[model samples]
Every structure is written in structure tokens, then in C-alpha cells.
Target: MRALHVITGLGVGGAEQQLRLLLRHVPAQCDVVTLTNPGPVAAGLTADGVRVIHLGMRGNRDLGALPRLTRLIRTGGYDVVHTHLYRACLYGRIAARLAGVRAVVATEHSIGDTLLEGRPLTPGVRALYLAGERLGRATVAVSPAVAERLRRWGVPGRRIRTIPNGIDAPLFAHDEVARKEARMFYGLPEDAYVVGGVGRLAPGKRFDVLVRALAELPGDVRLLLVGDGPEQETLRRTARALGVADRVVLTGERPYLPDPGDDAPGVVALLSAMDVLASPSAEEAFGLAVVEALAAGLPVLYASCPAVEDLPPDAAPGALRVTGGAGAYARELLRLRAAGPGGREAPQAVRRYDIAYSARKLMDVYTAALAGSTLEVSSP
Candidate 1:
């Protein structure tokens, strides 16, 4: 089937990267459209031979792009239209319907009780989202918690489908040689006790709390902040104010290899270099990096992360859920470090989130949407 994926922007954020990965496995002719800011991921998609069109949307109020998008969808003769992120869902769904495409689906990647796109969810936002949701056939949630949140936001329970975000597991597996090389590449000492967090440096991520936690830990413990965003300067200042600037390694937004065969180590090497993974974000729909860390055989201490919370204890053997705040995170880190590395492999449960599995499931969603089957929420 011919499918067209629409998104807000082609930045290297979790949702954008997830789309790049998903397209690699989707068994259909796929193309992409970015409403604005065709950032790094746009180039990566182009490198992968996927056609990416930029609408050059002036701003949120730019309604002119609607007709342009609608024309593209109608002229492209796409069999299905899938939207990702908020703005895309809002405009893409409307444009898809205008283009007369019946199979329309949206993936909710970043919505939480505390925040939506790093901003508090106001009443106006909810109304706008509900308006867009109605135009789609199904809304895919990255986790069960997110699906429940969608219901609370007035999306019908019948319209929500829970599909956990998937990762390329084997690429992230632990390797001693890789660890050594990665540390050297990052200018980190071989014996350093590294605690890493990956994602855009946004306020909702509570990376400020992570910097505070670093202050509470021993001087030898270091912080690795991956990915870049608006909070980069603010976080740098916080690290300096906390007197841990030198101890923190901020590797500005880097390209991630979506496929396992890519020559570069990419995120896998960065994850391998660390001793532990810490996702202190207060608002997380699905902690994709945390799952990658689990696949990499590193213990993860997350605060209010539904991705790990929804899993049974045995599902992610080394994962620990903790309260939100610097003190709580610091305590958990110390406790887990004291227990030492378990040398455990990723649990079989993690394989359920493999990208191949997600591809098959998504194909089912597309097929069901075309066949007019009522979609029901399923547990991951």
C-alpha cells in the first residue's frame, strides 16, 4: 500500500527518530511531509532514499499550508495517511480528509498529565486536539498509560490503540570493547561512574533535577546529557551553578543510526559507555532511551516513566521506578550502584518491543483501518 507520513517537523527528537525507524520496517511505499523545520532527521530520511517534502509553514497560524498539504495528499494518491506529533495530527488529519483518504491514523508520542510538547496542557489545547482526533480513524498510543491519558482527554476508548515504541535491540547489546572505545571518544576516564540521560534538553525532562542529583552524588560520578534543545543553555548554567559543570558531558544533538547495519555505533556506543541510565523526566509518554538502555544491559532509574512502570518487574529486570526529584533519584542511583552490575541480559519481554514486531502490528492497524474494523485498545 502507498502510505504518506506527516509530522510537525523532521527534528532528531524521539518521535521524529521513531518515524525514521518505523519507515525502515513498514512494508509499503512510504513518503514523508514535514510542516516546518526539516532538521537533521530530514537529511537522514533522504539518505535512506525516502522522499521528504517541506511545507514551510510560517507558524502555528499558517493556514495556507493546509491547501498545499491537501493538494499533495490528493495528487499523490496515497492509500493511507499516518500522522505523528501534535501539529501534524491537527493539520494532517484535516488535510487527509480533504484529500478523501479514508485510512487515517495518528500516533500520540508526547502527551502526559504534566505536559504536552513541554508546555502545560491548557483547556484550549485539549479542545483543539479533540477536534483533530475526530478526523482520524485510529489514534496509536506509545504505551498503555498514554492510551488511558487519551481517553481522559475525551478520545473515545474504542479509537485508541496501544502500541509500545520499539527499538533495534541487538544494536544496543553491551560490549566491553565498545564501552572502552566509546569512553575514549567522549573523553571520559575508563573507571568513571557514568550516569547518562538521553533526549531533547527540555524543561519537562527535568534535566535540572538531574544536575542537582549529580551534586548530591560523589565527585567521581559524572553526568552525560545527550540530545539538544531550548534548555541547553539553561541546563549548562544550572550545571555551573551546582558546581558540577566540569563533571557533566553535554554531547549536543547527535545523529542516531536507526538500522543495525550502519557502520557508525551512534546511540549504541554512547549508551554502552555509561554504567547506568537515569531518566528523571517527570513527563514521559514512553521512555524510548530507557528501553534502549535496558537492551544495552544497563540498570535504569526512572522517575514517573510509564514505559518502565507499565512493565512487570521481571520484564525489565534492571529497571527501577522512583519518585520524582533530585534526592529521590540520587538515592536510587546509590542503592543500585551498591548492588553492583547484575550482568543480566535483556528480558524476553523486551523482545515484544522489537521494531519488527511493531512493524507487523502497525500493518495490522492499517489493514484494519482499511477494512473498517473497530479498533480496540490492547495491552503491550
Candidate 2:
């Protein structure tokens, strides 16, 4: 079947990366289309030979592009239109139906409740999202937490399916040589304890908490911040004010490493080099970096949030939570450090959520949508 994976933008984030993985592994031939101008994600998709269409949406409320989108979808003749994130689902789902696509699905990547710090849903935006969601044949959630939150927002439970986010575990396996190489590439001391955090530098991620916690650590401890967003400047200022600017490394929006060919191991090398992975976000539906770090046999310390608590504790001894502030995070870090690196169990806990498995589950949803099967499967 010819499928189209739609998203807001081709940025460096979980939904886009997961889309890339799906394109790489799904059995059916697929194309990727974006509602905004293409960036990092579009480049990645292009490299993988996935066709991409950019709708050039300027802002969140810009539906003026709908007619263009409708024509594109109709001409593309997609059998399945699987959308990611909010804006893409809102516009793409409706357009897909208008274009006579047989199957339209959405994967709720984050819990909508936590999306805006528990703010009440805006009337207009909520109405728009729900209206489009109603048009979709099926909805998939990356976590049960995400699914329940959506259902509570008035989406029918029978129309929603829970499919966990996945990681390419073997891709994140521990590699000694690659780890050493990556450390050297970054000019990091081989013996220094490295704590890494990867995500958008935004308020919901609460990266400030991580910086404060890192400031409380010893001088030998290094903090690596990966990716970029609106909060980049604020976070940098926070680091300086905490007197730990020197210890923090902000690698802003680096290109994701190419496939883990024999020549160079990819992103997992950076994970392997880290002594511990910190995901101190205030909100998350499912943390991809946490699972990836666990797959590399590294420990993870996350904030005590609803979505984070859903992580499989049996997979890693270190998937523990800390309070939301800096002091609590510092104390938790000390506890984790005493436990030592690789203290977390092997990440066999994530086997069911591996990329290949999630891809198969998504395809099943697509098939059911196309076949007009409204019966939801019991929790897998």
C-alpha cells in the first residue's frame, strides 16, 4: 500500500525520528509529507529515498494552504495517511478525507493535558482538533498515558488504540571504541563523568532543572545538551547565572549522524559515552532518549511526571524520579552516581516497543482502518 506520513515540520524531535524509522522498516512503500517548510527531518527522509511534500504553512492557524493540501492528497492517491503531532493531524486528516483517502490515522505523540502545563484546552483549538480527529478512521497513541489523556478530552475510547513508542535497541548497543571516539571528538576528558540530555530546550522539557542539578554536581561532571528550540538562550543564561556555564556543552541542532555503517557508529555512540542520561522534562508522553540510553545499558534519571512514571521500571534500575526543582534533582543525581554507571538492567524491557514491532502494530492499525474494522483490539 502507498502510505503518507504527515507532520508539522521536519524538525529534530521524537515524532519525526520515529517517522524516519517507520519509513526505514515498514513493509509497505511509503512517502513523507510535511505541512511546514522542511528542515532536518525532511533532509533525513530525502536521504532515505522517502518522497516529501512541503505545504509551506506559516503558522499554526494557517488553513489557507488547505486547498493546496487537498489537491496534493487527491493527486497522490494515498491508501493510508498517518499523521503525527497536532497541526499535521488537524489539517492532514481533514484533507485526506476530502481527497477520498480510505484510511486516515493519527498517532498522539504527547499527552495533550501536559502539552501546555495543564492549562485548560483553548476553545477554538480544541474544537478544531476534535473536529479533525472525528474525521480520522483511527487514532494511535504512543503510550497508554497519552491515549487516556486524549480519551478524557472527549475522543471516543473505541476509536483509539495504544501503541507504545519504540527504539532501535541494537542501534543503541554499547560500543567501547565508538564511545571513546565520540568523547574524543567532543574534547571531553576520558575519565570525566558525563551526563547527557537530548531534547528541545523548551519550558515543558524543564531543562533549567537539569542545568541547576548539573551545577550542583562536582567540577568533574559534564553536562551535554543536545537539540535546540526557543529556550536555548534562556537556558544558556541560566547556566551562566548558576556559575556552571563552563561545564555545560550545548550542541545546538547538530545533524543526526547517518546510519550506523561500519565506518561510524551513530547516535548510540553518544549515548554509550554518557555515564547517565537525564530526562528532567516536566512533561512527556514517552521519552525516546531514555529508552535509547537504557538500550545502551546506561542509567536514566527523570522528573516525577505522569508520563515518565509509565516507563518500564524492570528494564532499568535507574529509571527513578526526582522532584521538579534543582535541589531535588541534585540529590537524585548523587544517589544515581553512588549506584554507578550501567547500574540499570539490560533494556530487554523495551523489546515489545522496538521500532520493528511498533511499525508492525501501526501497519495493523492502517489495515484495520482500510478494512473498515471498528473493533479495537484489547491491550497488547
Candidate 3:
């Protein structure tokens, strides 16, 4: 079936990268619409033969984007309209209905207990979310935890589908050659104990903890912050203040899937170069970065990870949930560094979150939407 995927922006992010990856296996014709900031991922989608349209949404209050998006959807002849992120969900669902599309689906990529897309979950935000939610047939939560959050926020159980975020497991598998190449590409010494953190360089991600933790460790220990955001300067400043500036490497942003022959290494290669991955973010819809790190056989330390927490302990043997601030991380880092570096085999969690399985599950959601049975969704 022909479908259109609407997202707030196409920057290098978990949800953005996941969308690009899932489409490789999704069994239908698909196009994309980015409300604003059609960055690298949009280019990646286009390179992969998917048509991409930028709506040029000026800001949240740009009402003109509404009519423009509606016209695009109306003329696209799409059988299903899938939206991602907060702003797109709010606007895309309304536009899909107005465009006469019956099958509308949204994926709640980030809806924390106290935040929705990094904004505070105020009464106004919740109210508007529920109101716009009524316009869609289903909301695909990235994990059971997020599904539960939506249900608690008054989204009916039948309208929420728990489809966890997935990854191309083998693509991230550890490789000795890749490890050497990646370390050289990033200018990281092979002997340095690299502590990697992958995600937006945002306050909520708590990357500062890793920097502060680095200050307490030896000079040979390095911190690698992946992805980019407004907090980039803040993180750099924190590292410099703590006297670990020279050892910190902010790789800007790396794509999960890179175009053929791209000079820069993709996330898979970068994962190979790392000794361990740490996610100190307390709020996570799904610990995608943690899973990817596990897929790379790198040990994972997370503050919160529904992807691992929802599963049994054995599912992700390398992942450990840590608490407290930089001191807590510093202790863990010292223990891990002392133990030395060696990647484990990809665990059961990696097999469970396979992208192909997720693709088929998503197809089921799309099939149900098209067949007018969205209300029959079952919990995962």
C-alpha cells in the first residue's frame, strides 16, 4: 500500500534513524514529509529511493503549515498516514482526517512521565495531545512503558499498540577490523578506555554526568558524545571546566544508516571502536542506544531503559542500570576500566529487538488500520 510518514524534523535522532531503518523492510510504497529541518536523514531517505517533501513549517504557531500539509496528503493518494514525534502527531493527525484519510497512525517516540518531546507535560500539552489523538486510528508506542504512559494519559488501551523500537542487529555486530578503523577515524587511541554515549546532546540525556565522571578517572579515559543539539557547547564547557576537555570527543552526529561510500563512519563502526556505552538519561521511551550498543557486544550502563527493563535480566546480560549522579558513574567507570575491555556476543535482547520483526509487526498495524480494525490492537 502507498503510505506517507510525517515527522517533526529529519535530523539525526533515534526516531528519525529508526524510521529510515524500518522502511528498508516495510512491505509497502512509502513517502515522507518533514515539517521542518529536513537534515541528513531526509537526504538518506531520498538516496534510498523514497520521496521526501519538506513542508517548511516556520514554527509551532505557523498555521499555514496546516493547509499545506493537508493539500499534500489529499493529493498523495496514500492508504495510510503514519506520524512521528509531538508536533507532527498534533498536526499530522488533524491534517490526515481533514484530507479524508481514514487510516491515521502515530508513533509516540518520546513521552516521559514528566515530559513530552523534551517539553514539560503541562495540562495544555496533555489536553492537546489527547484531543489530537482522537483524530488517529492508532498510536504505536516504542515500548510497553510508553504504551502504559499513553493509556494513563487517557488513550484507550485498544488504540495503543506496543511495538518496540528495533535495530539491524548484525549491522552493529563487533568487528576487529572495524574497531581499528573506527578508532583511527575518530582519532581515539586504541588503548584509551572509551566511554560512549549515543543520543541527542541534550540536558535530558545527562551526558554531563559522563564528562564529570571523566574528570575523576585517569587521563587515558575518554568520553565520546554522539549526536548534536543545543547543549553541545554546554557539554564542551563542562569538560573544559573539569579539565578533561582534551580527552572528550564530540563526534557531532552520526547516522544509524549511512549512504553508500560516505566517507564518515556510521554508528555501527563507531560502536565497534568503543569499550562501553553509557546512557545516564533517566527518561527513555525505549533504550535504543543501549540496545544498539548491546548489538555491538559493548557493555551498556543506563540510568533508565525500558527496552532492557521490560525484558528479563538475561535478555541483556551486558546492561546494568546505574543510579545517582557523576559519582555513581565514576565508580562504575573505574570498576569497568579495571576489568579491561572486551565486547560480549550480541545478547538475547538484540535478537528480540530485530528490525525485521519490528517491520512485520508494524505492517500488522498498517494492515489493521487499512482494514478498519485499529480498535482491535492487542498489547505486546
Each prediction's TM-score against the native?
0.95, 0.92, 0.97
lDDT for model 3, on a 0 to 1 scale? Answer: 0.90
Stretches of candidate 3 off by over 4 Å are 257-262
Candidate 3: residue pairs that collide: none
Could you give candidate 3's per-residue lDDT for residues 201-283 as a string of tens digits? Answer: 88899899999999998889888888899899999998889888999999888886457787777788888888999999989
For residue 334, model 1's alpha carbon misses the true position, in angstroms, by: 2.1
Candidate 2 ranges beyond 4 A from true positions: 116-121, 259-266, 304-308, 311-313, 343-345
Best by TM-score: 3
Question: Model 2 misses residue 375 by how many Å?
Answer: 1.1
What is the descending lDDT order?
Answer: 3, 1, 2
Candidate maximizing lDDT: 3
Question: Which scores better on TM-score, 1 or 2?
Answer: 1
Which residue pairs in candidate 2 collide?
A: none
Give candidate 3's error at residue 193 in angstroms.
0.5
lDDT of 3 at 232: 97
